[model samples]
Target: MRNLVILGAGTAGTMMANHLISKLPKKEWKITIVDQYETHYYQPGFLFLPFDIYTTKQVKKKGSKFIPKDVRYIQEKIELIEPEKNVVQLEKSGELAYDILIVATGTKIAPEEIDGMAGPEWYKSIFDFYTYEGAKALRNKLREWEGGKLVVHITEMPIKCPVAPLEFAFLADSYFKNKGMRDKVDITYVTPLGGAFTKPKATKALHHLLEEKGIKEVTDFNIERVDYENKKIIDYADIEIEYDLLVTVPTNIGDALIERSGMGDDLNFVPTDKATLQTKDYENIFAIGDATNLPASKAGSVAHFEAEILEENILRYIKGEPLKAEFDGHANCFIETGGGKALLIDFNYNHEPVEGTFPFPGIGPLNLLKESRMNHMGKMAFRWIYWNMLIKGISIPFVSAKMSEKGKHLEETV
Candidate 1:
């Protein structure tokens, strides 16, 4: 039997395992998934953790639950990957060889990359919502607090869920207002980008929302270091921003194993074919999700869309056929504006987000680039879909892998 090994059991790896199990013949193939942790986190829900929108229980589940019974699940730390020998070395277990390998070891937040960011103040006054522990810590800090200058900053880009930091700022505004402390607190969003978001049109809309909500935006500020002693962040331009509570999204990098294996780029992200989702250097190895250095938003929806196309491409590879260049960097996200409303944005590599209907042209229950209660409902409902349909490799109806331009107004190409 041919052995297939998956590196991580995160969203991307889980979906690929489930999808492949159904497509590949069980009699001819043996599948194995490896991960150090037992629980699988709903990373997007991390953004709402500080606002008490989602509890730890609501956003976490055992990795074994989502993994299929047919596939072998190994819970252990990965020491290194012997790519040349086509084997994986675990910390405790012996080496395991594979006929095909999938590298889905996702990106992680490296707070240590920023000086003093993870020093004495970590989880006390300095917090990050990217991890479950940090989110829980932030929740405790936000709970008995009278309110002051709260700074939401992004240390760098290519972080998971690019819009999450902005969403956190919006949610904080709502949370403080609901507590009747809106007047007592001031919120500031700092980023290296020139605007609120990476995309141009969305940035304009987001900038307006920030201004209207009384949230300050400090743009184009490349952080030099965090001065924890002074409770301030020093940027490359020598600008200093002080804060009482700092919620930062630190620099995100791929798994350290990627660096050990010498198969990754400067940021440790595996160089993947933008169209095929296959590693640039290895024909038998594939990459997905935040693991790949694809020029796309590092979000869960992107992984879901990539899995659909990758499933087919994997089959084609086994048959010795030409792999389809189907992935289009399609990504869509719901920006929670709080107040029981949200806005949705849909775009791909060649197009920016525009105002229109979504999943249905001219008849969407969710509107694009416009805040609506329906969009909020859709955002909340996604958690259910993620557990039931998405991880099970069930394709979402009406949502194509390539973004549709039918409902959007595209005046300029991305």
Candidate 2:
């Protein structure tokens, strides 16, 4: 029997486990998934944690609980991935050979990459909301402390849930307002990008919301270092931004296992085919989620879309068939605009997010590029959907892997 091994048990790896369990014939193949973490986190919930919108218990569960019992689940660190021999060396367990390898070890925050960011000030005055611990710490800091300068900054792009920093800024606006201390706090959003978002149309819409909420914007600020002693962040251009509380999304990079395997790029993201999800260097190896250097947004929605395409492609590869080139970089995101309202945006590699209806053509119960209460309800409802449907590999109704352009208002200005 041939073995199929998967790395990491995060959103992507766990879903692949659930997808392949029923597909591969039991007599023909065996599946195994490895991750250092036993606890699986609903990473998206990390955004709401600092604002006290979600409790600690709501975001995590045992990684084993979501993985199929039929699949071999190893809760151990992956020491190395020797692609040349198709073998994976575990920290304690001996080497495991595989006929095919799926690398889904997702990206993570690297605060150390920035000078002084992860130094003495980390988890004290300066914090990150990307991790469970960081979010919880920031939550406590926000509770008793009277607000001062709350700077929501993004160190670089390709971070998980790209819009989360913006959501934090918006939510901070709402949080302080609710505390009746809106006048006491100052909120600023600083990013390396030229605008609030990546896509042009969405940026225009989102920038307006930033203004509406009175959150000051700072764009194209490439941070050189954080002056923790002076309570300020210094950019390469000599621009300085002072802050009492700094909520920053540090640089994001893929797992070091990819680097150890010599199968990754500079950032350790596996070089993968943009359409097929196959590693460019290895025919039998595949990659999914933030681990791959795909131009797509590194969000769970993109992973869910890729999983559908990959499941089919893997079956083709098994039968010695040419892999299908079908993934289109489709991504859907919910942007919280504060005050019980949110906006949704959908797009693919070739298209920017525009005003549109989602799932149905002009009949969506949700609106795109416009803030509404229904969109928020959809965002809140997604937490439940993620656990029950997304990670379980159950297909979400009304959402397709490939993007549809039927009802999008793409006829106007780009």
Candidate 3:
């Protein structure tokens, strides 16, 4: 049997596993998935954890449980990926060779990249909500902790769930308001980008919300280091922003094995064909999700969309056929605003987020770029869809892998 080895058991990896198991001939292919993690986290739930909207039990499930029985699942640390020899060396298990390899070992936050970020203040005042432990810690910190200058910051971009920090800012605004401490606390949003978000229209709408909510906005601030002693963050321009508590999204990088293999870029993300999702140099290797240096948002929806295209391409590859499907960098995100409302944005590589009804034109149950209670409910309902449909390799009803222009209202340029 030809070996098809997959790295990582995260969302993208798991979905790919389930998809291939159903497509590939059982007699011709033997699939095995490797991951060091035992538990699979619903990462989006991390955003809610700090706000006490989700409990620890709600965010975690066994990684192996989601994996299909037909495929072999190994829990172990990957030491290196020798792509030249089609070998994967594990710390404990012996080296495994594969005919085809899928690199889905997603990005990780490297807080130490910034000076003094992982110092004594870590987990105390300097916190991150990206990891399970950090989110839980921040949850505790937010509780019984009187209001002060709370700064929601991002060290750099290409982080998973790009809208999460903004969501945190909006949620914090509402949280403090509910606690009657809105007057007692001061909030600031710090980012390296020149605007509130990557897209212009979304940024304008979100920036308006931040201003209306009285949350201070500091953009284009390239973080230099965390001043632990002074409780401040200094930027490259030598400007200092003081804070009582810092909830930061640290610099995101790919898995160390990618760097060790010499197959990745400076940030360790594997260099991939922007349209095909195939590694540029290695024809036998394919990359999906945040593992590849795709210029798309490293969000679950992007990964989910990529999986469909990847599944088709892998099948074509095995049959000695050309890859027909192409990934468009499509991304869908829900931006939660304060007080039981949220906004949804859908776009692809070419299209910026536009204001129009989604799924159904002119008459959408969910509005785009505008806040609505229905959108908030849709956001909350996604957790259920993620668990039941997404990771299980099931397609979402009425949602296509490609971004649709049917409902979007494109702005005319002169």
Instruction: State every prediction's TM-score relative to the real structure.
Output: 0.99, 0.99, 0.98
In Å, residue 300's CA in model 3 sits off its true spot by: 0.3
Q: Per-residue lDDT of 152-256 in model 2, one digit per residue for the tens? A: 999988788889999999999999999999999999999999999988888899899999999999999999999999999999999999999999999999998
Clashes of each: 0, 0, 0
For model 1, residues 1-414, the per-residue Cα lDDT tens digits are 999999999999999999999889999999999999999988888888888888889999988999999999999998888878999999999899998899999999999998999999999899999999999999999998898899999998889998999999999999999999999998999999989998999999999999999999999989999999989999988999999999999999999999999999989999999899989998889999999999999999999999999999989999999999989999999999989999999988888888988888888877899999999999999999999988888988999988988877775555
Worst 10 residues of 3 by lDDT: 405-414
Cα lDDT for residue 240, candidate 1 = 98
Task: List per-prediction Cα lDDT, in the order shown.
Answer: 0.93, 0.93, 0.93
Residue pairs whose backbone atoms clash in candidate 2: none
Query: What count of clashes does model 1 give?
Result: 0
